[model samples]
Target: MTGFDPAAHLSEKLLERIRARAAAHDRENTFPAQDLADLKDAGYLAILVPTDLGGAGLGLAEASVLQQRLAGAAPATALAINMHLVWTGVAKVLADRGIADLRFVQEGAAAGEVFAFGISEAGNDLVLFGSDTDAAAQPDGAYAFTGTKIFTSLAPVWTWIGLHGLDTTSPDASKLVYAFVPRSEEDDGRVVTRDDWDTLGMRGTQSRTTELHAAIAPADRVVRRIDPGPSPDPIVFGIFSVFEVLLASVYTGIARRALDLAVQTAAQRRSKKTGKAYSQDPDIRWRIAGMALAYDPLPAELASISRDVDGRADHGTRWFSLLSGVKHRAVTMAKRVVDDAILVAGGSSYFSSSELGRLYRDVLAGQFHPSDPESAHATVASAWLGPIEP
Candidate 1:
């Protein structure tokens, strides 16, 4: 693993192709189907699966680096693929911990099957700990889900959706059920995807709303059923750790791209007063330096935490805070960098066609993801100050 480079898997030529299509996909508000095809061909979907399972057998640290590279080219494409990677990463986590419940996920990813994360629900702030959807248990032990999931990334082409719901009627009344349901025509009217993904940015994700009408997850697909509220279940840890690290990696990549753009713009643009490039201006130099100062530590932090996850290093109860804190810092830093990059580029970046303009919009979506600003603060506060008295 010493000399492993993400570039070997995600080549520069492939990234350029993905980068070239990004603007068109953003402008048209369409899914990056070709990007998905290329990534699948590159074996990126199975990067976390074991080598014996027909995958690259890379660890989480390597996957984080690769995701950062992907995001630098196309944020929306990288974000959409993040969902698929999440499932595979979680599978790796479980397998590493001697739990094989999600082995199917790894196998499916190795076979080029796309898995969409379906945990998000409108107005449900409980996240992984709770769910608004109904998990009606059938006599055969299969559970039928009935609810709507928002921001279902890769919605147009997801082969299986990994989701959770509350099982209120089962003997274990308040258990939270985690399961995976296949996306197939034979589902009857169980699963419906709304083509309503037009957004401010990250439009290429096509993260549409999904309505589930008794979408059935067979018994084998029901991976976990844990009590409501915080639990030490491996599934919870697996999802949270993988999701946050990959998310941070994406935003960090965005910041890296923004900083690079700023440097390029500063070097190319001439200053009216000095008749020299803006890169020579004191103010411009300071601004780019500030952006660099902010961007410098993110990759190191991502690598450290991702390696901890891969190596199964124990962090006790500090895991949540660490994960949320990195995501919070990465997104905020990316927004800052993109904002400064636009300032460095001047009015040229204000136009819709500008890459900075797209980056500006794409970066804004970071705040909307889980472990958002408020949640991150709370998690950190709880970890440091201990939970408030009931």
Candidate 2:
């Protein structure tokens, strides 16, 4: 029960707690404190850190599966925990593959020290923006940093924040630099959080504005100067594919639960509007059929990406397109399926005490989650169009 066993290693107990907290504080928009604590306690948060650092070292494939599974279990915690997982995965992948020796990031991750990333700026991709002057970096052996890194997904709960800012002195985008600073250190009332994240969706995410006031240290800095430029390597592309695949794969599970709830309620509840058995309607059958159809492709797309990554095959831009497509379709379909449930189930879906409301909002908002559909299309089109667009 303690070690890795795929199907048997499910975090049912932890997932239950997450579902509870998600429903409880979900309306309050607070951090999933208890759930996150459970994640660290159960070793579910730091699955990517090396064993030497007291972690599971299950690799990226396992990591993606775990994230996707948790999303089905609880989307709120899955998302918050995702910020931690991405930092750990990138730091570990970078270190182990001789890309960068972020041994400190590794040990810190195992100790339950959550690391956050600052890639979402005013105008760029949150997922490691491909910007030269638009990225984050450090100056020699110094920790104090200055840059406007916004909308850090886990700002409220993170210990270390991976700040990727533009190295003002450098012109080389290939030499992509990164810095890590303690959020506590930046809490001198210097950093600012704007209230501009009042979006119609994913409101509970608390993804607000983070404004840097001063400088960051050097020892805490992780990825020094590195050529983060163009590489057709699937491994490099796999890093991105993993998140896209996880997002898609996870929503696939949510859709199943939504469909289950809708169909089950149909048999038990009689619609006052029609004065007929809800289960006896043609619309109900068609809805179930549609949900079933929507549920099919997500896992297949996830499997395709996983199979490719596991095999270490060449990941062309076309592959990136496929992975992005999986994410795009999954979230969009999940939103559609949940919206239909709301329409069919009516007032029952909005009952605050019910799972339907929370799940519906989370799943619906998930469609707009940071994985950019436009960019995914662009990344995919790069193959057919040839080279990245200027």
Candidate 3:
């Protein structure tokens, strides 16, 4: 299917309804259940799954564009669903490279199964390299994960959770086991979802804490068992590449929306002293210009990087640096754009009801996601400077 347009799949009326639900969900601190259902009904959950597998058969570039649009309407809902898309995107990345290890993930997404990412843990900076969660091998070769996972998005509703843990009993002692745990209440009595998602912003995400006490990932579902730390494994590259790009897409969308709101406010509100629209004021124009300057390059850059990933263009060892750099740039730029937008919107924006205000709080969350500012810097430095000498 040539000339595929991802945007055409989602209707403006559908987006309006999702946008209408955003503030209410944020105010009530509730997940956007209806939004997720609507997106699923629209076949959004299967965007990356191949057409042959009963999906849209789109690529990262398309998904990134759609994510930016979704985030503009409702950031929390977009962010929550991003975790599920990450897994499906990773599965697509792997499949493109002749690996079908995650074909079930594709099939599951196409079948409307919700997959949540469960890799995050408290005090674990070694992300994807090492794990604080325990992975004990059972007599049947299956592994049991026992530990706490923080920032577990889609915590309230997930059919499967992809996670990792350290298996000390292995020969290397730091063997990281990567697998998916099914959401079975009977076999997994130890899994606990804490009712504590209250936060400064992005309240609709419902990213609660999860306590996994010996949650089981059957032997057949165990995807990878490799030494901890960096490796040439496709799984590692797939996750990093897809996760960082899609994440950048969400934040870039936030910036785009904030900038748009600022423009609208400037055009409508008049300055009392000058008795003219804020859009005519040199100062307001300058602030909006600054926001545009910061926001303009991001979507294009995101598109380029995403296409490179889809095209399987080889950046060799530079892939990590590129992925992390784009993510870092998007987050920092989005935050700046939102800050300028709030200033342009004036005191009215300070109200909790203001979408810009909520966006300001939501943009703050970009810093905390994986491959954070510090890690991105380190990865970029390592890419250019090589490993630092002892």
Candidate 4:
């Protein structure tokens, strides 16, 4: 419970190494394998697991801080790592609530097994509340999932994928099945990862499409079977809370980096009119100050909510709204800051080689993650005014 220091987990040296490779990975449209390797060596994948389980035993708050630092250096690396952390974070949440179904997730991560999130689907607006994938139940209480998942981050090296599908035939009929399936070639083509991750930004994430053809999760891996659409299941809460908060942390980190770059650019660039650093220019000073103003509140906000989650504060039904709201704000603020940074950095930022230009592209990815703008507003609106009338 002492003051948490992100540097202890992600050293400046390691981060600099990761940062140095970011543009190359982005340009090549490839995964940050060395970054992942370095993180694994640092035991970052197990940061959320309890110390008794051979991890750093940090809470979501600490993990959030660490993610921010990591993202500041190499956003795509931090983002891909977020998927692995999500499962471990969920395991911590479940363990905190006395649900040990996912204890193996904690243990697996500590042992170097990489877990990827696979919940997102194409055209499935219901999100965590619904699934387009089919979850056919087996007599032994296992389930076979069949569908395609888009934006499956860590697609290249994940050892296990945590995903969900709809169960329509079980007597529990119409329940959403949350399960984990290993990434094994022994499945004879049941699990397929598509090598198609070309995108405008966050290219190092290599988040590609995945096809599951009757991908089986043995009984032990079947974590939850809950009714779809806004249930009170701990799994739902754990996923929603951790996912949203970590996502916010990532974009907030992006904002922090953008603001820092703007400061550096302002300090280094000379204004022709005054022969002084742009940092002293009235307009440049105003823009940098404005960027800082926008960026200031994000870390505090992320810390407060993340601590609430770690402390298990009873936000009650307001949880969804609070989580989504922070994520939405962080992303929008990051985009604004990056845009202003581009202006302050002037024409140099327009080139693809500019770090600001790379950041400009990377920051755009924030809007596409879960609890998207429309959904975030809807969740908050429902918390305040209730659902729309049918």
Candidate 4 residue lDDT tens string, 1-390: 477777889999999999999999999999999999999999999999999999999999999999999999999999999999999999999899889989999999999999999999999999999999999999998889999999999999999999999999866458999999888832589999998999999999999999999998889999999998889999999999999999999999999999999999889999788899998999989998999999999999998999999989999999999999999999999999999999999999999889899999999999999888999999999999998999
Candidate 2 similarity to native, TM-score:
0.84
What is the full ranking by lDDT, best candidate first?
1, 4, 3, 2
Task: Show the colliding residue pairs in model 3.
Answer: none
Model 4 TM-score, all chains together: 0.98
lDDT of 1 by residue, 1-390 (tens): 599987889999999999999999999999999999999999999999999999999999999999999999999999999999999999999999999999999999999999999999999999999999999999998999999999999999999999999999866467999999998722597999998998999999999999999999999999999998999999999999999999999999999999999999999999778899999999999999999999999999999999999999999999999999999999999999999999999999999999999999999999999999999999999999999899
Q: Where is model 3 more than 4 Å wrong at Cα? A: 185-187
Better of 2 and 3 by lDDT: 3
**Pairs of residues clashing in candidate 4:** none
- Please give the RMSD to the true structure for each candidate, in Å: 0.9, 3.7, 1.3, 1.0
Residue range 1-390, candidate 2, lDDT tens digits: 136565433557766666667665566666667777777788876687777778887766676667667776677667666766766766655665565556677788888788775666666553453542343333555534555666566667777777655554556434445667677665685466555655433444556677766645455464554455555432345356555666666676677667777877777778788888887888887886787788766666666666565455665446766767778888888877777766667787778667778778778655555566677677667757887657
180-292: candidate 3 lDDT, tens digit per residue: 98889325586888999999888898998988899988887788888899988889998999999999999999999999999999998997898999999998888899889
Residue 63 shift from truth in candidate 4, angstroms: 0.6
RMSD of 4: 1.0
Q: lDDT for each of the candidates?
A: 0.95, 0.65, 0.92, 0.93
